[model samples]
Target: MKKIDRNNLKTFKDFLIVEGEKVNIVFSTAKYDRSFNRNNDEGLKNIESLKVDFNVNEVVYLHQIHSDNVFVFNNNAKEFIEREGDAIVTNKENVIIGAFTADCVPVVLVDEVEGVIAAIHSGWKGTFNSITKKSIEKMIQEYGTRIENIKVYIGPHIRQCCYEVSEELKERFLDKTKIDENELFNGRNLSMERCILEDLRSLKIEEDNIYTINLCTYCEEEIKLFSYRKSVGTYGRLFTFAYKK
Candidate 1:
């Protein structure tokens, strides 16, 4: 098992990869000199460059629809399908699974004991629908992954400090989870982390095994992380990926 050096980790341009017991995780930021948006040709080039850096044969990108749908990577398939889903899980090595997000939560789950990994995109809608929980259930059913042995990482996103929501949205999240109104909505904004953490704990994931970057994409101006809320309609996306190797 490779121990992760969280304090001494390095970044390649705006990309950062962290090693774990059985999986390698990578995250891309908007801080690079060039554009790292996954919506254009330049973004494709940057993604290819990351593939080399991570030493993965291919990177599977999802057609995210903010739905609870989870795609299970089938390496035995003849063709690579870009399916519409919010999360992906697989046991295949050397194939990086990834998702794009501007304000949504990018979650990576690794069952080191079972050698299974997952990449999830959890926006407000997806989180409300319990997408992360669904993905873990899928892994457990398909890969025999034990919930307690799974290590989870919740990447940067729009935190409650900057994620103001409408009354209807707040009520919907409240109805979906056990989080209190005060913690769920801080007078002006909704707490996405609180809701997500609650959902993970409900599924029996140990509190200590779950880690969060705790950085707000909308609050950190110096980091250059993409934020749809802050940029309005002119923002790019940050990529989060994971693979077992």
Candidate 2:
């Protein structure tokens, strides 16, 4: 459990050392762009950083669609082409799982014993579709991963402190939630992020299995993150990933 502040953004690193496995979950701050076709400058730098500790060639990244589609890389890409998916899981060692986000929640999951990891991009659409549950189900069904042993690291995104939405949107969120939403926000809450976590909880995930990084990309947009809502335009994306070798 460690937080790294770089380029004015909060990058999370979850190191896993067990059974001869060296796995890590790394997240990018909003300062990086999400729409990279190849390994952009920031992406290259991030990959290089990870390579210093892992295999750079084994890293995999997705072309993040807001939808719930997930893709598992076989390390068969020509250069670094982005795909149209929101999640990726792999049991292969040295294969990295990467996702992009600016204000959206970028989630990373790891099953220590099985040595399987997933990198996810959980946007409003993804959360509404329950991408966490989908990813967990995929792990269990496709990779023989035990849900109880899953450790989910929720990376930095727009926090509730500044995640204010209209009353109508809030009500729509509340309508979908079974838990009391009254105390979720001090004065506001990030409905999308909260929803994703609840979705995982509903899937029988333990409370301790979930970890959240309380960094707000919107407010800290100029500091170290790239915020779509704050940026007011389409631009680069952050490089958030989970790599194991």
Candidate 3:
């Protein structure tokens, strides 16, 4: 099998790509490209630069609301519809499907055999509502994706070390997962990554197929990743994108 040519682009970090597969999974850093501040003109330029670098015809994303809703892209759609959802899936080639996050988990799911991919934004609210699980289920239902054939990459987010939560939120997670309160929450913080992984495994995704970048946005200030908890006044958001060539 041909090996995947990992791009060492200064703007983004290539997270996961299978040998001989047409798909590419990548997440932007605070390095050369700083599209995190999406409110200004520079942010728009950064996004355009990313599309150029990735060589995708268009970058499709959602106006995320931390909901469990997943939208499937229609290749023939005229203008990109600004939908309020948390996930996006598409079998359409050469178009980047993505999500923006500050401290929320950004997940990219790929079924190489079926040439289908999905991008998910799972914050505490979305994870609580089982958004990742719902997105995978939608992929299987609509695109005939096999659970075993799917590869998942969970990107940078706020980990338990830096993600402090209220007592009520902690109790809600405990009640939902039925895990012991102490096990789920380390003192006052909750690991959203753990909750996401548990949900993925519960959906029958193989443990080995799931991968995580393990970088905490809130903790890694030197990396300069956008963190909502760290700085909420900024309108910056990290853009994670995936596309099938």
Could you say which candidate leads in lDDT? 1
lDDT per residue (tens digit) for residues 37-150 in model 1: 656898778777766887888777777889999989977422443577889999988888888888999999899888889999999889888889999999999999998898
User: Candidate 2: global Cα-lDDT?
Assistant: 0.68
The model with the greater lDDT, 1 or 3, is 1
The CA lDDT at 123 in model 1 is 94
- By TM-score, is 2 or 3 better? 3
Task: Please rank every candidate by TM-score, starting with the best.
Answer: 1, 3, 2
Candidate achieving higher lDDT, 2 or 3: 3
How many clashing residue pairs appear in each of the predictions shown? Answer: 0, 15, 1
What's each prediction's TM-score? 0.92, 0.78, 0.88
How close to the true structure is residue 207 of candidate 3, measured as C-alpha lDDT? 79
TM-score of 2: 0.78
> Which lDDT tens digits does candidate 2 get at residues 1-245?
33433433323342222222567666554333334324457556655565565555566766676989876555675443466788988887766667767788888888887878888888877876788789888888887998788888777677777777777766666776754676544444645666877777777788777776666777764446767778786565665676665
CA deviation > 4 Å runs, candidate 3:
1-20, 37-39, 76-78
lDDT score of residue 231 within candidate 3: 81
